[model samples]
Target: MTFEEQPIDYSNYLPDAPQARSVAAEMVATRQSEQVKAALFSAKQFPRDQQASFNRIMQACQRKKLAEEAAYEFPKGGSKVTGPSIRLAEVLAQNWGNMEYGVVELDQVNGVSKMEAYAWDIETNTRRSMIFNVTHERKAKGRINKLDDPRDIYELTANMGARRVRACILGVIPGDIVDAALDRCRQTLKDGYTEPLTDRLRKALLKFQEKYGVSKEMIEEYVGCGQDAFTENDFLKIAGVWRSLSDNMAKREDYFNITKVHVPSNAEEEFLKLQEVEKKEDVVHDISTE
Candidate 1:
């Protein structure tokens, strides 16, 4: 018996060929499975209600596969980079998968911790904890292994009110330490805030007082008079004057004497104002000139 040739219903058999082909191409690009692509294409052939369920499954599977691939490639680990600028928290988090690395936990006060890690403030020689605070944590998070930009360090320290302390303690006192201090004090006063007395300044004051038998009251009086207002030039001038007296003291084993000296209550204020006056007209004369 001769069989009649049956014309294929290509439309029913193919079933949204364009959409199926497009979705299959996307699946292949996204590293999805052929089985998943076929199932998704088949779902388009079903009733709308059943189609939604199949679509959801296809999407979930695709997502799951993508996630697996990402985890496989990237993995869960910290950056391998190292340097002064790297955020201690991120480095710790990446390597340890959490804040706790080695035996140290993140201290809210100090910051992150790692064994044998080193960090130095680029502006000064001061070494800080390898751990970082929340703010620093954010700021230095993605920095590569390199010395942090000096400006970045300065801004960070200034914002934290730690610059003066760092400068003093590290003996990284800039040539313009006095001027910098004055500027800081001015900003503090302008903001109606109190500036922190750095340990270095305190130590310097104590040493000076001990050497000269100067009392706290005298120091307070000088400070109250705004001796801190002296500009860097004024400080240099004062240092020259002091050095002359010190040289004389070294030469003669006797107490240096100055009769009719106009000792201002506020040395910093007098110093700044006098330096300006001297610069303008050389009107105010120092006892050293005599």
Candidate 2:
């Protein structure tokens, strides 16, 4: 049988009247956990020059923890039955102010569960959403029965949302970087390589290198391309490569050897600095005119 396609108005599910106020108040009043407090304090210990970066890292960790906590409740036997069930409505309610989170009814058409998600856009006050579908069937023979499992659903939803969020975040990154990466990837793809690394891929690898400072030889080994032969594709392959690396990284508490390549000094810095100055100028111009 096909999954239900009824137009269930989520408006009722949305926190309303007193409920909305209560939720908003509770959200505003919620105190940080002891772990978060410790993290923040530890972050403060970083050298003064690095304090801002440390704070940002700590804040990201806190946000991730909160998001995970808010998205799923771990009830006993939750793992044995199905996957973790997502608190979709709750997630939406909590992020209502900052993100446009909403659920769209899905129709089980062609054996796929089609759903749409809405996210709040900070740049534009309007809500932005995307729709994608996944097949209920699994590639593995026995995996089909596990399709409806809560954990599975949660994972799928998380993956979909993650891709969208990554795309959104990419907007904030320098366009030239992205374009460079894409150009490299396209070149590699055109050269009869099954998988050509793109510029996005290269930047991601550089980021990894920056964080961990891996050796040039180690990077060449992992990437399977020689330093001299490291075309734009090889350099930029991080975009696609990151998809898999991100998942593995999530499970590991410590960073691993992901190979690194030398990035030309001052390639991205000058451009990014110029962009920042221009942005500041625009802000100043606006303020002065106003």
Candidate 3:
């Protein structure tokens, strides 16, 4: 089964979370326990400026005997949020309006349990979504029958949506799933790929990528390749590459490692910035071991 993006109708942007929230509350809680909180904090998942406010809220929670709640939230504009995904959504909504969220499967074919998640990026000012055509069937544990499991598509949707938002929208993770997706895009675009170096074509290509929020370095690399006219296949290859990287799948440097994907030497600056950011996230705002 192949996953293709389906056009979203504006009339179908309903997001039903309350029912799922109640059903999976216990499981979600277990997955987000104090231990998990401590570990994530140690991993420096939260932003730095929020660190002081987070500590203050936690201290206040301790005084008020609400440490349990504190583990799930930080003081935010005199309110609170629990999960990272919800916080990210709120951040996007605040920074960029016209935000829409939805999850649905059009037709179930091949036992795929396919669902598409939609997200909007502030920088891009456009709709972004990821659809998976893969199957997710886990083995039952402890003599439990698969049908007896209550963690159904709702749990999967929530989990997958959160993860996609993190990796695609926020650009936090540079993992295998994203890497494979980029590689696939590269492969798809490499057919009859040629660089056109004409003035009009160069400007047009640059404009196309800018509209889609592609990095300047990436566009420059591709535009410098050919001095002739562009072709339909050329458009497909270029669009495929831009759309793939526009989701911010892998860091700029990863393209160098990606065979058939060319990266100019100057693009190393973006990779260096990504490395520095990751290092800071690895060490900063770690939860105290004591």
The candidate that achieves the highest TM-score relative to the unseen native structure:
2
TM-score of 3: 0.26
- Rate residue 155 of model 2 by lDDT: 65
If the candidates were sorted by their TM-score against the true structure, best first, what order would they fall in?
A: 2, 3, 1
lDDT of each: 0.35, 0.45, 0.44
Tens digit of lDDT per residue, candidate 3, span 1-290? 99999988865565567866786987767875965456445434432333443333223322222211111222235342223233333333333322345566645555456767665432233556788753444444545323223367456456656655543443422233233333333343343235543544566557654454344444445544443546544544454344334544333333322334443344675888889998887676564432
lDDT winner between 1 and 2, please give it.
2
Per-residue CA lDDT of model 1 for 1-290, tens digit only, reads 89999988777677587898999889776774654455455544532343443343233323322212111011013221111111212221222211111222233234322222232322222343433332333323466343245555444444343322222222321224223333333333334314343433455446544555444344434333344544333332223223333533121112222222333346766788988977766434544466
Return the top candidate by lDDT.
2
Q: What ranges in model 1 sit over 4 Å off?
A: 1-201, 216-224, 227-230, 249-290
Which 10-residue window in model 2 sums to the lowest lDDT? 78-87
Q: Cα deviation in Å at residue 262, candidate 1?
A: 18
Question: On residues 140-252, what C-alpha lDDT tens digit does candidate 2 reach at each position?
Answer: 44454537775676566566655554444333333443343333324433443354445444555576666545445555665577666776545534333333345442311
| Per-prediction TM-score to the true structure, in the order listed | 0.16, 0.29, 0.26
Clash counts per candidate, in order, are: 8, 18, 2
Error of 1 at 193 (Å): 26
